[model samples]
Target chain A: PDEGAMAQARELQGRLTKPAGSLGRLEELSIRLAGLARTCPPPPVDPAAVAVFAGDHGVHAQGVTPWPREVTAQMVHNFVTGGAVVNAFARQVGASVTVVDVGVAVELPPSPHLLDRKVREGTRDMTVETAMTRDEAIRAIEVGIEVADRLLDAGAHTLITGDMGIANTTPSAALIAAFTGADPGVVTGLGTGIDSETHHRKVEVIRAALALHRPSPQDPIGVLACVGGLEHAAITGFILRAAARRHPVILDGVIACSAALVAAAIAPESVTAMVAGHLSVEPGAAAALAHLDLSPLLDLGLRLGEGTGAVLALPIVASAVRALHEVATFDTAGVTDA
Target chain B: PDEGAMAQARELQGRLTKPAGSLGRLEELSIRLAGLARTCPPPPVDPAAVAVFAGDHGVHAQGVTPWPREVTAQMVHNFVTGGAVVNAFARQVGASVTVVDVGVAVELPPSPHLLDRKVREGTRDMTVETAMTRDEAIRAIEVGIEVADRLLDAGAHTLITGDMGIANTTPSAALIAAFTGADPGVVTGLGTGIDSETHHRKVEVIRAALALHRPSPQDPIGVLACVGGLEHAAITGFILRAAARRHPVILDGVIACSAALVAAAIAPESVTAMVAGHLSVEPGAAAALAHLDLSPLLDLGLRLGEGTGAVLALPIVASAVRALHEVATFDTAGVTDA
Candidate 1:
């Protein structure tokens, strides 16, 4: 954060037309953007980009979620063809969607918007063994960093975190438990409307995996190698790189937020780059945001993750910037203050 | 709400790619729109209009607020000149602004954007006598009805409620207490950051008005006549008119919510046309929303009135409609449902 720029923003807000602090969080957002952009009137949130990281979770072998692993590859195609809700939302918000094949079991055809950066076919079944090797984890994180570098180089102002993997929230919940020290039952949620039986089994699957790996929070990367999804590692790297570059990143749902936990543990300053877009209906999402001490911009109870919440929040982020840039000050408008 | 259109909307939401109920409140909002539009895919919330109802309160002389009553007329000028926060937000959201002078104490010149509909100079202080006569209150309501009709006839699909009256929340608090039966302190909030002494005095004034009037919630019009600002009266009638015309209405802070409570009390079905824009920092806003059984779309601790919060909500309301109209169904996208 740029202290000088932030101070300038705080001073500028005091001169706006309405009473001091009357705009509430909008005023706070402008100040935060000033620090990130290093400008009092920060740039608009667009041209924004949503990186939909596609991967297959080996835990699909367990019946944690009814969604088939093939759905991961299919959804990546949907994203490429602009057939997904995230695609609709991106168009509405004037954001571009990039599909990154981080780790998929199936072969995918190359496309203009697709980034071929597969670290592995997938991870081993986490309920029975470790998810991925440490080297593979590092490589996945590197892929995320590379994606951020490319997006920012292409003039994208903000990066929205997205993921497409069946049962991804299962690993997300386990990651949240490992990082935040929350009980499994407390943080675990039925990912896609699973029955009570499947939900209970999913909780046990996480407990078993935790017991087998005994992932340590001190070693965030090692913990990722043990229980995190490939997309999770990528998102963690994406968040870290965004912060390292002082760019704003909007986190989508539990998957991105759980990844944020690992990213924050690795570099505490990385959390500064993150913006909680909205509250997902999943329990782990709220717990993760609580641990991060970040308030979401919107809470429509949305749980569909493909960066829909983040894209939906793009206009709001832009509006906060526009308020600072466009609203007349009391001195300029000659409006009396209370 | 149109039951047939709403049923069709529910079926359409199920066909969307995401799992059932995963989109959460967004799906509910689309259904509400369908009911309002009487169509499965309702019209976009665009071509929306915000009615900035400016008025004055007799309680201003009682030092309920530090802002002079003349500021109300000054703000009407500000609204017309596009110098207010509401104008900035309206421009950002692609909405037109209409300033209605329902009861400004000061004389005003005409402008293309300003509507001169002063029912009286201002209402009498409720602590002294009834805030307004029954006939004046009815005329104020008629002004709101006319404004809604004109906006709707001009091709607006949504009407946003905005209030710009100095010390208006005084009447809003009193109206909330009368309708929701909440204690004065529980509902009364410091308007525009009043000093602690004035805050306590504001609470006592509300208590005194409630004791003197003992307004009946069942007789909502009588209650509005007893102690309500002209803007509040206008907004109540605006909401009622919108419901009758099957148009969507986005409500701002306590002033709008307080009027909404009166509107709902008069005709319970009128609540169907209303959308709680955001949770105001004012305590009374929450109690009124709870009593109305409407959850706010955003809760950014906003207390700034003049349609600021409602304009911020336009994109969100539009996104819900776009999802229904634009998102690909699972059958067409070849994506299996969860």
Candidate 2:
């Protein structure tokens, strides 16, 4: 039944007014819609929701970023207060942002936009112990799935997955290394602008975590428990829920891309609904993108996390979909074939 | 006087919430607003207008693109009929598109969105005669300026400059080479998907045009007359008018960028209000961007012209300006210093 929908979606995109194959991934999106909705010209996408998963990493104790872990909680405050770059972008795009406190050590005050989905105060120090337990990982994933369901029920046709975590790149790097089978030294990069010496140290931190975890890709939940941050696990679950619901999800930057790799491992078909917003300058981001066989729509050497990349990319996606839905074909325009 | 406005614009952007340097080009845009409006927090950008200058090149007879000359009129019809990609994007973004017939060999029917401002039916073949007369070039430019004034009076705070001309790359390459001092071989590229052999032929076509015109950048008007297409001259005028009116202008791809280079030569301060949407994979585009000291906000290897890149980028610009106007300051959010 899903295959039939996918086929019908592809046919509908082919019949859109533009030249064959002109709308690019948007054509893929329209086709994906057919499979998901079991209808042609899937109902207009409206009321998009953005889930920004916030967490902190034990690797902060290892001094990966110059910024303190407390800044993570403060930025979460900024997000709730609409002061962060992502808040501005989300507001401009007319998407409501729900910041998930999956694993911040500091407690967040209750607010409409803040979702207290914390599985733990913070992940266990991966340098010494597993970052999370299997149960915690599952709970985080469930949190993500629940958020996706709520957004879907609230009439969000698109769900943009974003993450906010200080020193989170350490876990993300560890996850990328395990999934892509890349060495830690090859996949890890300077997070938040570490010097060459610090960058090397960051890599060692990732390598140490990898050695301690020895995560197997076949055991996705085990992998998250071993090395993934709470935000990573949550994003993975969110992606799955979005896929299962047939809603398109835009992945932002390296951390989100790493989480997406985990989601894909959980459900390969989920990869179909994903659109990479931009290729981050981070080596791990490139590795993750290559592993997923997904090409980013923009490359501006942007390393700023938050959902800024995804928000910047939203208009382009809308353009592609609009092209697929609106441009007249050669026959309709009475233009001769090339 | 313009310098004062620009300084004000910069100050306004600097005051917007989020880190001072976080939003990058968006911060630059907020500053651009001060300069354009000559006031802080430039009034909300509304009634945006995209003027698409359409022309025809005598060089089209030389067989450049797989597309024939008639396709220019046919596509213009598509634009008028709202069947073009730009139409869909503009509609989705809530901007008006004005199709200006600067130089098309065929007569166009009157339409609400169509602006008939032909300098001539078409340009003289640059490989033989100068493409346009100096007087005709001025007239076309005047047409662009008048369009800008009309749009501004109609309450547009932003102007998007687009162009549509067949075999326009011939003139664009020549102009880029003359202005940027780039080698013809390096700056010339296969436009509109011409095969290698035809690509080489197009290069020869540009070289012959350059040899015949021997254009100089010092005399910007003379350069426009020598090899600039009608649409190119018109865009130059449009950009200047936007700057003079303190309105932000979004530049499309290679052809528009090439015209911007000429406009910059005429009035260097004009560049203060211009934002490059994307770098066209067109060889001349990078050189043009470098000469203008402008970095493109997006690069997806898009070579499709017709203001499509600019229209796609509009939302990002809007987001940036909105960020300047909306995002809270560190003090307001009580977030820690970076």
Candidate 3:
């Protein structure tokens, strides 16, 4: 990101026909985008690609969620058949959807939008052992980086994070607690609707994992390998790759936010390329976003993941840059300023 | 609105492939749209129409703002020439922009998108006398209703409110203060950037007008004639007519919010069709929206009216209904629920 371009964007915003700061957050978003593009007016954020990383969580065996582990494979089919909520939202925003099978237990047959990048069938139960070995974690991350490279090479102007994994929120809560040092209760919430008893058991499961592994925030990869889901590792890699390329990436709900924390810990500068798409209902999503110091673009109480929130915020991100490029300055339009 | 359709929409939302209530506010919004359209899954709110009601305020004599009154007429030209912010946003959402000159001070020639319906050159200075006679206020309200009818007849599924009137914020603050029974100081704010001293003076002006007219909230027309701008009255009519036809009307910034107060006052049921597009930086907008009991879809700090906030929110509103129509049910997708 270019600081000089940001300075130029701020100067340009002041000279636009509208009052200074009247556009509020949109003006700041545009300025940050200018820095990302290294230009006074960044190009439109369009033709976005949504990479939905599907995996299965071994924590489901511990009864953290009521949903069966097979639901993960079922959702992958739903996403491919364009019957999922994420598919509908992606269509609304004209963003291409690609499902990456990073760690689903089922052997998914080849499909048009499916990417077979299975590092393993499913993660190990963190209550008993690490979610994955260090090498397997790194391999899953590479899959994410490779998928991001493929999408960027295909001319996607932006990247949107999506994920589908049964009981994935259990790992997400553990990841957030490890990174932010927040209490397990503070970061854990009802995922896909859970009873009070289930929620309490989920929190204790996270606390037990943290007590056993003692993951350190300084070593992001170690922390990820200890408790993070396969999709979480992949999304972290996707965000890191996008940030390195100076392109913006829109993050979805709790799953994506937890991955973003990992990405930010690994490369502090990656936060510059990240956009918090929406404030999810999951309590951890807010804590992760607050720790990252990113304001979400929308707050519609959305709890569903799978990149739905990111796709919904695409127009707002595009409009911010479009205002910079399209609006006439006071001098250009010959309009008097206050 | 059909309660039966709303109930059916709720039933369908629970059966969506996603977990029940996972979509959060979007599910509620879809249900409301179903009631408004009298169908389980409402049609898309597309090919929308934005009617920017342009007027002038004689209250510019008060030195409440630094912007020249001529900016109002000049902005009308900017809108017609497709150089304004509203024009850029409307083009982004594929919505048509129509300028209705209900009360501009200047006599403008007709243009392709301009509707010549000037009720007067401008309202009288409220500090010296009533802004307009009761008859003129009624006529302006009638102008709003007629424009809404025309746009709805031309195949517009949704109506977005926009306004351009120099010094209109003074009257808007007064209208809000009168309708909400709030202190003038609490409702008045910097309109398009004003110094602290000017802001104080604006509050005093509103207080003085309220003191003089003693407008009653029950007599909605009297309140408009006493302390409201012509565009405010017209927007009130626009909201009323839209509600009568059971179509959604998205409200913009403080100007639109103040007018909404008047419309809701006249017919309490009109609140059913109103959608708060975004929370403006203006203090009165929040106060007015609170009085109307409507939650805004976006809170991006937009203060420049002209329907930019409403236009930005159109996609979110459309997607809410799209979810109901496109998302597969759990039984249909053959996915097990928790």
> On residues B1-338, what C-alpha lDDT tens digit does candidate 2 reach at each position?
35686676566555543334545566666666666666666766655788888999888777666777777788788888888878888886778988889898899888887888888998988888888989999999998899989888988888988888778888898899989988888888877667889888888888888888788899999998998899999999999999887788999989999999999999998988888988887889999999999888877666667887787777777876676667666567665654
- Candidate 1, residue B196: lDDT: 92
Query: Each candidate's lDDT (Cα)?
Result: 0.90, 0.81, 0.92
lDDT of 2 by residue, A1-338 (tens): 27886776676555543335544455665566556555555655546778888998877888777777887888887888778778877766677888889999888888887889888888988989999989999999999999999999988888888888888888988999999999989988766667888888888888888888789999988988999999999999999998888777888888988999999999998987788887776789999999999888777555667778777777676665566567787777887656
- Model 1: number of backbone collisions: 0
| lDDT tens per residue, model 3, B1-338 | 79999999999999989989998888988898889889988878886899999999988998889999988988888888888888888877678999999999999878978999999999999988999999999999999999999999999999999999989889999999999999999989898989999999999999888999999999999999999999999999999999999899999999999999999999998988898999998999999999998899999989899999999998888888888989998899988887
Candidate 1 residue-wise lDDT, A172-218, digit = tens: 99999999999999999988789999999999999999999999999
Candidate 1 lDDT over residue span B89-115, tens digit each: 887778899999999988899888799
Q: What local lDDT score does residue A176 receive in model 3, on the 0 to 100 scale?
A: 96
DockQ for every model comes to 0.64, 0.45, 0.78
Q: Which predicted model would earn the best lDDT?
A: 3
